[model samples]
Target: MELRQMRYFVGVAEELHFGRAAERLYISTPTLSQQIKQLEREVGTTLLIRHSRGVELTPAGQVFLARARETIQAAGLALKDTRRAAGLDEPVLRLGLLNGVPGWLPAALEQLAADRYPSSTVTLAAGTTVDQVRMLSSGEIDLGLVRTPLTLPVATTSEHLADEELGVLLAATHPLAERTELTLDDLAGLELIWIQRAAAPEFYDDALKRLGDQIRLSDISMSHSQLHSALRVRRGAISLGSCRAATPDVVWRPITGRPLVAKYAAIWRTDSHNPVLRSMTVSPGLTAVRQQVVAD
Candidate 1:
């Protein structure tokens, strides 16, 4: 059906009263009723049971209501994106960031502001790579900093940001905590804390390939904070994370020979006309940060 039909259905479904729905939609009750009837005809099934007092949704109505709400939300987002692209909206850049973004991202953003789009304001949202990618696709965010080895959607593009060496996060009291550096062989007998694969499939797979056969794996589902808490309490347990993710209570030591690295990329929609996005993507600061990481 049409977007207008979906909006009308959602209004009526939520209100359950023709008069109230019409009032909410800024239309007359007769018009709302006529549109609902048209929607029912198009669906070839009864959606609502009319009564003198109020309305009740039929089983088909319940299903249609859910889909109709989704359609309306999607349409609203599409319209907003279009307006923003056409420069009809305020210059606000919504940026999505995966956990543990590198230390240089803020500097890069500052460089972007000074060099281009000085009037633009940026808001940041934190999520995993998968969540960031989904947000980018749905027009919830204009740009994303996500872990690499991800497959971008057809409408999106990405550029390499930086690559960070994987480091061991261990309890302060652990035996290996005294070492300045660790090797893959040193991690063989330790219990490894595993991150969920669905969060970043490529990173997960690479982690498994690197440690699955050598280390004793512990599959515990936890967020970044929870993982840090677990590390503080569990003596022999360790996790592989970016060197830049070091916290005060844990010992973060770079892996020695055969280094493991996590790559990051800046992702954005191809259709976005946000000039700030282009500036962020091509910032010299990012290139300098990449070079510094490589030098380290």
Candidate 2:
């Protein structure tokens, strides 16, 4: 139910075709479809009807479309007024972010972005890699700290930053937690953490297939905080991840032979002219991750 979701819906409602709407919005068709589904969930009704010929707005969609447009207009007016009153016309380096970034990164980014261009300020918004891609395409963010590998829209590009072994996560008290390394057979009867597929359909499907080819996952449990809780309380609860979240009760372990790896990259619009944005490396996301891996 974010303004971004509303914006996505408006695009589709106008074009009556997901592909055409996606092109107009600079986002992939799948991403646009996912957002519309989410918006429908929040609104408690189906907004669009899809069939062989084309897409049609449901009765609810027709009503919501009018309101959605009005909301966008009102929001635009509010933003313009606020910007004028605040004299915030100065250049800004807006960066979309993901989880597992180092704790002390934001303060460093503020100074780094400021140093890169004249009178430029840095701003950050947290989202999944899929969300970052959408924000980047729509000009809501100038750059992003995102997980890879993903397809870049024609208007954007990415620079590879770092790679991490897709390793094990479990409670320190778990029987196998003491192992320095793990083999695929070690996960024979273990359950894994759940990832929200709707957030990033491409990555979710690819990653799970990659893992499944090597290991036999019994089932998926909860995610995020709930994931930490399961891993902390149940010795059988296990997951593979590259993120180094500060879960004191949980531990990360390298998989034997490194069957899979996760990657991170900095993404930005190819035609961007913002000096600070052009120079961004997502510094803190990398240095510290590499440092930690080396230390381990």
Number of the top-ranking candidate, with TM-score as the measure: 1
Please, what are the lDDT tens digits per residue for candidate 2 over residues 169-268? 8888888888888887787656776566655667667777766654545455454446676666666778766546426677888777536776666688
Model 1 ranges with Cα > 4 A deviation: 1-87, 279-296
TM-score of each: 0.68, 0.61
User: In candidate 1, which residue pairs clash?
Assistant: none
Give the C-alpha miss distance for residue 231 in model 2, angstroms.
2.0
The runs of at least 3 residues in candidate 2 whose Cα sits more than 4 Å from the true structure, single-residue gaps closed, are: 1-88, 102-111, 212-214, 218-223, 246-248, 273-275, 279-296
Clashes within 3 Å, all models in order: 0, 0
The TM-score that candidate 1 achieves is: 0.68
Worst 10 residues of 2 by lDDT: 285-294
Instruction: Residues 19-127, candidate 1: write the lDDT tens digits.
Output: 9999999999999999999989999999999999989999999999988877876887887777877778666778786776675764565556556677888888789
